[model samples]
Target: MMVDDRAGRPATSSGSEGHVLSTPTLLGDRYQLGEVIGSGGMADVYLAKDQLLGREVAVKVLRDPEPDPTDRARFMSEARTLAGLNHPHLVTLLDAGTSADRPFLVMELVRGTNLGEATRRGGPVPPQRMAEVGAQVAEALAYVHEAGVVHRDVKPGNVLLREDRRVLLADFGIARLVNDTAHHTRVGTTIGSPAYFSPEQVQGLTVTPASDVYSLGLVLLEALTGERAYGGTPTEAAMARLNRNPEIPSTLPAGWVTLLQAMTDPEPTRRPDAQHVLERLRALAGGDDAAATQLANATQVAGATQMMTSVPPAAARPEPTTSVPRAEEPAQKRKRPYWAIAVGIVLVAAVIVALVLLGDRGATVPDVPDDVPSQLRDPLQDLHDSVEEAGQ
Candidate 1:
């Protein structure tokens, strides 16, 4: 299911007769709601017009007229977390308020499909584009994590790909503040989408920024392979990760292989942080060898573990290094061949014998060439004189 940040399958709510909005369904007295663009478990998103700003915005209104207290708190928590974050890669929050007793949130409407749809419509994305997507999403994750927010949902459905080649991470409805101890999940239940959950999330452990990285790794792997990391029912998908790590394809470029493997490591501490992920992804996107090399070294130093079920231990894996030569440096050292030096010596001896024969015939020998080596000249002259005496 493609879950748009603001749009999805129609969710029947009290506000309108199904997905279409009733005439002039105005909220906050400043925005006019139109047709439903997205729907989720919590809210229904509509393409709305902001009367004050005279711009198009997405309005997400609570689906239930009388929601549970905890659900309402989590919905409002998303608003608060989004309000504090102001990153270019993250969707911007416009407004939030209660209208007609329904809590609604206004956000900038991205004018393109989510990554889920894009990948499905257009099969496997190229390596460069995948790198760009990963880098942009990782950038958003780094910012949100630094702001003390953990985006519990980071699947392809939550990532929007704008028409202008820009990426925006959306749908923080299940986001949790890192320091807040209050648990949001019900007993024996998880929060995020099942197929994208990290190992820790599968085990009902604490979720962190690395969890987002693992999810993004799965997303990128799916994008490249055109197959979900985990398939089947929600429970089946969630339980699959606990026993095995997602299989990263061997055909992928080395940089992508290293990054995806490290990101999806079962041990949370072995996964690279969002910032480091961002740096490496950017390097991959830009084809920057130097930056890639630097990040690879950092990944090794940070003990970025590769969680491949079929592979041998880390010590057995070959060391991956980039040794791109600079333009100023020579490609290889010039060396004199042994055969060429031997041929030169033979030619010099033959030339000295010829000079001695000329002097014995009363013919003046030509002056030794100045190009000859100083030490070789004396030896050649002594050999020529001995040959001349033998001829006499």
Candidate 2:
């Protein structure tokens, strides 16, 4: 039987409502809750300060009491899975314990937004930024895979970006420890975001590291194209994964397109592992640098070609008149026309302007106010005064 929660129905276990504790305040003594950061059907995350460490941290608390044996087992498994991971690109699990009647996890508080929010507001990031993020995430996955864990829920919403722009994979609540199959049997249904789920996950097959890579490919595709690789409603996102092929974005870089295609291959055996993906992305980034250099060289060659073509041909001299006869037929000297001179001057000026524009292409120019002197003790005083006046 299922019981209806705030959103809808969820699998229910036999437990009294009194067993679930109400919200308790433990701010300054243990963790100081700043505000609610996020909430979902299963848990709510809060921005808090860890009094013990004197640093900010995020606390995620289960929505209901873990009195039920099944729920308690699953919660314990999650804690064990997180405790086993120690990677720079993964959110550090600081502490986990039962507070009051709810099970809670303390994690590193990321200052920046999640990938989902970033992509929605800024569209796709630059290729270089995407590659950097992808590489870090791949490395994080590799580390976790080596530890014999499979992250069943890898998606954009679960990937956090730190203030320094580093990627931190979050939400290992559903991750299964390799030896915890007994606990996994209790968690009845799939626990991953539909849009980024691997095909095997949709088919109810056991998840592996390659499954993580498949999901990572979906995330990378979204990061590069500002759109989901599969088209469907939110509820249908998982169903779409069962299809043979996902649509590739037309605007993605050639190398990235190839990488994503390999990652999202339907057959888990055919898909590349996290380590392989990391190496490929690193190589792609290096190749991009070389390609940029080649483009610059090509542009220079084209400019040189244009300059050579524009040069006037060598002046042709009439054959020397061996015979100095026929003085009457004096050679009429053609005067250089004023219009020709004007045209030449205009061409030279245009070339100078073009060169100036090209030189400024990659240069950063500072903006100065008209009232500011070229050199002064406080040239910015007028600007400050203007700002103050505007505020007034």
Candidate 3:
């Protein structure tokens, strides 16, 4: 359910068997396919009518009708994995089968845009709302972690924003099934999107739930900052992380700065577990459950309405819109630019160290990111940069 770009591509119908699909197609004599809703690298999702169930469902069909046994096995693994998860923060897997050896799955049609679209439309999410969304996603991640699964790919594109303005973390590791890294690596293709890849994953180490937490941290950072922490060519972005930490901006709520730093810590072991992350985020959301319940009900109503109406093709919805972040917090609460305080702390520490080392020599301190490692911000580097700045 990575319902946006980068998780997969949109559909291209060449023919019925190996190419594009036709509308009004019947699958298993029970589901009536309408228009193609979403498409990714390996599958095409359609808004379809579940005739037997008397409801609308998102039907995902494999593009390759005659995929090899390995592909089939991987598809079945997604089915098996999804069958075990029943969290409200996840996309519900309804049914699955093969027609002419083409695999397809019937899913609960979540009538909402993905987080990528939402963020682009709404800009940076408000602090409280970000906490609510992140908490919901973390809760889902906690459940899957307990179930012994890792959502290797956790990005904004895979997160859905419901009509009620809440969100759900979708796909639950399904991307790993189709994103075969071996061949991609052989051809110099990145194993995953560099902007969201964890350090361990980029390093080719054994990925665990910790990796998922790292990816989640990046996604949360992007949602809150209205910017990606890393970019450039895939290799450059991934390798950049090996030397430096994410820029936690000189602006952010204090709690968010602390929580995000902990979550995105260079050492995976230092990062908090999903449940702990969920607890912290829930605290940030201000212990509200009634509002969340109302949001869920809104989503249910929206889904029901979509079920009754005919869905337009993906092209018809060129830009999916989302609700603006609620900006009604009282003035007593502060949120923006908390990272300025962090910078101040780093500056004070640096000055104290410089005074101790310089023995009262009057010299200006150089500016740097708050979290720059001591090794990179060594005395020599600072002296060199300071001298260079003075000359300029």
Candidate 4:
């Protein structure tokens, strides 16, 4: 479930549309809405019971009755994006629809607290536990990035810690497909939480999966240190990342220092991809040489597999298998028009007559090449015989 400090209170300030439920409310004819479990800037999450399936689920309803068109589109886009993704680390989307113009999403109710709240109350997480959480979130990122979606908003509040100790990455409302050009927010407006914004995101540049990697790096660093990588107001925090790299503590293991430094690099491309981050975190969590060896072997196998299936170098791209057919294709399609052959025969006969009349009788007529089509060649031969007889 999305843990919030504002539980049991209304999500909206003045509107009756998003007022807290003092009584049991039935939404979409199948969900029995109870107390609001989580509240955010855009939506309020309720602990609901799925009457149809007889299971406990969390429903997120938009906070405004008359939402901006862009917000509504983003709400629906989250539903669509989550519906297609199925992964262990990702929160599953069960159902979605609008009730009286207020959109809602039904997801599996994760009985747990978010990483932000957990860390705030419990202080810094141990290094091994932090690595575990980072690994899980990184694995989730790897999955979503492969599916062409960039989780533009990746932070501690969005990372849920289940009671069973499994971590889930949730709240994909601001997420967008990497190839999707239609943005929910207007141009020049940044979307994610300011403190967690990647450098490219702070500058309002085109964001990619690398931006998510950067944000996750910040998240992991905070999990380890119990402090944000940047401070001050939203604008100051967002701009600070662009000016310099996050401060990774010297007390962290050398492996962690290296990973955090690489992840929070000022240059987006300098950061490691999510899959690599996942492997590194997992190895770190293992805390032994055996795990390091396993990671090395896995990486070697992955490299060899990638090389085997990768596009061949330019030298081998022009396939020899198709070259023979390519060379013969033009000859196979070579065809001459019959009318041209006839015109040529007439022109040749006229030339011969002109030469004879001019007293150059030794000059001979030229014959057609052997490659002419039989359909025209046979007719030309008959025409040639007729011309010879007429001349005689």
Candidate 5:
């Protein structure tokens, strides 16, 4: 039998291996640590199960050399910030407490891969998919912004893609509560990914929603192009963000170009708000304008062809006789003209009916004149007659 140090399962210890930290029988006797998920400068994240709730969660424990009074306060404040935010796209903070002299945050366990891993494994995502991801993240940011929180780090690694392909924004580690103590980010201390950091963040200024939008644009760019919009190295990345323009990929959807441009605008004020981004995404996804037009044209052509094939030939009418009794001849002659006119009118009506039926089959009909030419205006005239008959 072998023991897994991370899972805290009992196992045979090998003398050759270094001693592992004894798994504490109790993490405040509440959360049962499972496996290490990830570690960052401030904390180590673990897959944990909450014994009380019998539910899986992510536990992020502060690193050793516990945070100073000020840091601890800030950490607690972050927990409060997460507690206040109620959004589907954000990771929900379930609980927070001090355990073994370390502050830990129990968060909703988000299954599936992060954007970074997905991008690395599969090339750039499709433009439509990228738009979807961006829109979702933007909505999350919008919610946090409304709560007066600024997520200082909005990079690909913090964005997770779930099994159902929903985008979830995670790891709000460096996020700051706007109403809290005034703490300006130190200059030259790069907080977010250089490739995705906005110019304002690079300048060590207080980050805003616009900064998040700028970072999201970079993520979108990478997702669409399958490569960083800036450069390879950190230094190059920073410089690119500061001085270079993002190269628009030819494969990107035309409607989305404006959206990307607005997102990556150097001037924060010029950028579109999250609400606007959401609207645009909805429009694209629901197949508005361009898509609808294309579909209408396609259906119209098919309808016209189908109508021509299904219509029955006009029924033959008996021809009026020329000869009759002398006395009745005059009456018959008079009736002949009337019968001829009625037959002509019936033939015209039949053509109109055929055209209207064809038009009703999804073909767009042109406007009809009051005295339309018999040969050139059947389709439009037929539509008018059908409408008039329906009203009657």
Candidate 6:
């Protein structure tokens, strides 16, 4: 359950439509609203019971009822960004809709403490634990980047650590899709938390996956030092990194110092991708790359166990001496989910449609700030409409 910012009162706030979705309130005829677990500037997060799934979920409802169209569109973009992602270390978006013109996102409720609260209560984490947490986040970001998403905010508060000490990066409210033009990301208006902002972000520059790496670097630094690496107001903190680097202790765990510095480097091009960071952490933690190793083995097995290829039937079909798909004995017991393949094909088609839209929009540039991209001109009106349609 999320902690209510207003400790004493019920987690009730008037929505743009002038209604409060308090406890016992039923949303979409499925989610039984419970305690107000968390609150933020834009939305109030409620712990709700999913009657359909028979599980707990966190419902984040937008606070602004009378938001301008731009705000509404940005909300939809955030939702679509979350919807496109599917990864273990990222909070999954299960459902989304609107209640009385107020959009809400139904997400998997993550238990255990957020990294900010955990670090505050426990101080710096154990070295091995830190590396493990970092690895999980990096791996997740790698996946997110591969999907053409940039998590603009990568901070401790946005990271949740489960009981197993595994970490999940959450809160992509300000995340920008690859073809997204930052209409909201105007000059003189920075998007991310200042303490964790990259140097280019401070200057209002175009961001890439490496920008997330720089921010994650600060988060891990705070985890290790038990102190914030930057100081002053958000604006001041944003500007501080312009002339200086994060002060790191000369002494760090074997490979961490090098990794940390590279991540926080002022130059965006200098930072390593999330995958490399994950690989380095795995090396330092002395853990085998189970996922990579399995992929390699699966590739070899699949190639050798092809049922019918250019070769003759007897040569193509390996003798079924063993149950697993291997060269010598290729008795295949597992079959891939055809439905999953169909879904993949459908999603690819949808993306191709979206790409055409992106291309069409690229022809007509928006009158946005120099910092914003020319190709990202369209207001996410279509995405915003989809949210309402989903809810209905």
Q: Which lDDT values do the candidates have, in the order given?
A: 0.74, 0.63, 0.65, 0.73, 0.63, 0.67
Better of 4 and 6 by lDDT: 4
Off by over 4 Å in 5: 1-25, 68-71, 184-188, 289-392
lDDT of 1 at 178: 75
Candidate 3, TM-score vs. the true structure?
0.65
CA lDDT of 15 in candidate 1?
A: 36
What are the runs in model 4 whose C-alpha is more than 4 Å off?
3-20, 289-392
TM-score of each: 0.72, 0.65, 0.65, 0.71, 0.65, 0.68
> What value does the lDDT take at residue 135 in candidate 4?
91
Q: Encode model 3's per-residue lDDT on 253-312: one tens digit a residue.
A: 656665676567555654567877787788668845444334433332332111101222
Local accuracy of candidate 1 as per-residue lDDT tens digits, 329-390: 12121133323434565676776677665655654434344344455678766775666566
Task: Give the candidate number with the greatest lDDT.
Answer: 1
In TM-score terms, candidate 2 sits at 0.65
Top-scoring candidate (TM-score): 1
For lDDT, candidate 3 versus 4, the one ahead is 4
Question: Candidate 2 residues 1-392, lDDT tens each?
Answer: 01112222211212222122245457335986555566654666766777777877777667675455665666667778888788888888888777776778888766666777778868997777888888888899888887877788888877777667778887777787545546544445556678888877876666677788899999988888888877687557876554335667647666676567667766565456777777767766676744433432333232211111222332333322121122212123213332343354455444434535565343332233332223421534444334434434
Indicate whether candidate 1 or candidate 3 has the larger lDDT: 1
What's the CA error at residue 158 for candidate 2, in Å? 1.1
For all the candidates, what are their Cα RMSDs to the real structure?
26.4, 27.6, 15.8, 20.3, 27.8, 18.5
